[model samples]
Target: MGLRTRPIGFGYFKTKFNDKVLQDEQDVGTCELLQDSKVRIIISQEPEKSNLLRLEEAPLIKRIELLFHMEHSSIPMSLEVDVSDTIGKLKERIQSIESIPVNRLVLSFLGNELNNRSTIHECGLHHQTHIEVSIRASPPAAASTASGSNAGSKKLKLLVLPRCGTKKIPVEVNASDNVGELRKQLPILQEKLRFSLPSNGYFFIHKQSVMDDKRSFRWHHVNQGDTIEIFNGWVTRGS
Candidate 1:
């Protein structure tokens, strides 16, 4: 990392040249010659200097694709967002597009909830990386309705991705069933995917958090086209 010439704005004058590299302190006299070369020389394996040099070459991720997985909205809008934008900034962008308050929404990628302090790259997202966007909970009355009768329930289609596998299972679940009930259907899923199910290592996830066993489908506001993801772990990552 230190071999790369880093363009430190207005910082060229601050670094002290290695006198041993030049052979004499008096011989290292031309600042103009150094600026034209644009190289930061580090002869010593000093941990602190190497760390600083690594920071100087930090990767730059400009854009990422976000897949909004909302209960009421199933439209797969492929959004390209700036990686420099922090998670908070990304929320604000979504808020402007969806008109939902940023505080009421959560974003997750690869089964991890993004924090306000993290940038997209810091959150392990890369170019064309897909993320899940959902409401933190059931929206206000304007957005939600009465729970109504359970008889109206329909099949809830979900995509379950195993941690150790690349294929995604199209899981069919009853809208009236709580997320925990999905476990009963695991045998069928295992048969379809031909993959061994985790004995005690998995749970249903939404909004980057584990679903409550007692929460009904009504409480979670699940609807058609909404996903019930199964991440590989006893608990959600970075939950």
Candidate 2:
């Protein structure tokens, strides 16, 4: 038993070297607080039970064919529409298949103009595209060589003046009628002026000149109480 020597203590190796330098300074302060904070790790996406690989395909409404082009006509109006309609419903379907007068047309495309509340896919149009039709020019015969004519069962009170909301309305009309027959008296003057007339057709202006919906408010010399002015689309002039 002479070789049994026991000795391993300097306060137990200085308390295990101060608990291994306080656990290596708490593992270098948790690796410098995960290298200075913002440590986001996330990883959680588990949602695909596979109902045929999570099926969800149903979105295809895109119809466009357009071509219109008729300035002098050589035939170009194809119109398949539905890129969400609305250049005033493609001018009421080109005024019902080309009798033409959705306020004298005037569509246009790459050369601009297209704003009847815009849409045909917001004017990007697509498919055949070509557009441009223009028509509007038709009021001038030098006021039908004036003679101050006026007798188509005489009526003429007028005083309309409406670009929006009420400013004045009056309206009696007749004196040989024909300002496009006052659009059949616009639904009895929109129920005695409660408003809402222009369904894509309105134009009159008087003294500042523009009338001529085929003439006759005494050939637009208009009289009676005077002051016509309606206006709402369809009035274009520029070289």
Candidate 3:
């Protein structure tokens, strides 16, 4: 084989070779074209499953004790749940044991609803610690009116407005809920509004009477639409 470069015309160079040489060149060019053809690459997604596993390597994976308060029942039960799991799953567990449906569930922790579509860790639950739950029960078929049941023993919808920049909270109250029971929700209120209520020397008043630890809402004749006043440990006429 011989290789040569020769000029043909117009200062634009061209090369003329022998037939055998030209054929060899064409074969080489064809080989290059074949080499340049598109090639396919196959990748697997199995590693992505591993990455998903690693993403959960956080402090949110821990075991915690949860307490369930069955509606209308004074007895409470305890269960173990992982902070990594959603509270929705815990509700499922409760439904399995208590025969209550998850959809009808009303769960609260530190007086806050657990139905926020968040994980236990995200909601600040901790490992090996106990939390409480209370089920929302259907009202008795015979109960009626704002004073539906005795001693507010039945549930009534009520609004609680703290005398601050705080917003009003509409909550279901039990006829059994007394002044002390209402005060227990102060921690939740402080957490939500980032403010504090007077720790001492304060009292809650409904109408003319000062609410005491011994009486329920029904004792004060507090109806559904009534608003109780938070006073500085005392009450006066029109106070």
TM-score of every candidate: 0.33, 0.25, 0.33
Position 221, candidate 3: lDDT: 81
What C-alpha lDDT do the candidate models reach, one value each?
0.65, 0.67, 0.62
Model 1 misplaced stretches (Cα beyond 4 Å): 1-60, 138-239
Q: Check candidate 1 and list the clashing pairs.
A: none
Q: Could you give candidate 3's per-residue lDDT for residues 102-184 as a string of tens digits?
A: 77777777777876478888887775444566655656553454444353467777766566556666556776777687778
List, residue by residue over 131-214, the lDDT tens digit for candidate 1.
Answer: 788787665563344444545465678776665445667777776777677777778778866966666677777766677766
lDDT of 2 by residue, 1-239 (tens): 11111123321111112123122224445434444444222222332233223233535568968888888788897978789878988888888877877877888888988989988887778999788888886555534434335335577787776764567777787788788877677678778668666678767788888876777888677889887778787876577
Error at 38, model 2, angstroms:
34
Worst 10 residues of 3 by lDDT: 12-21
User: Among these predicted structures, which one has the highest lDDT?
Assistant: 2
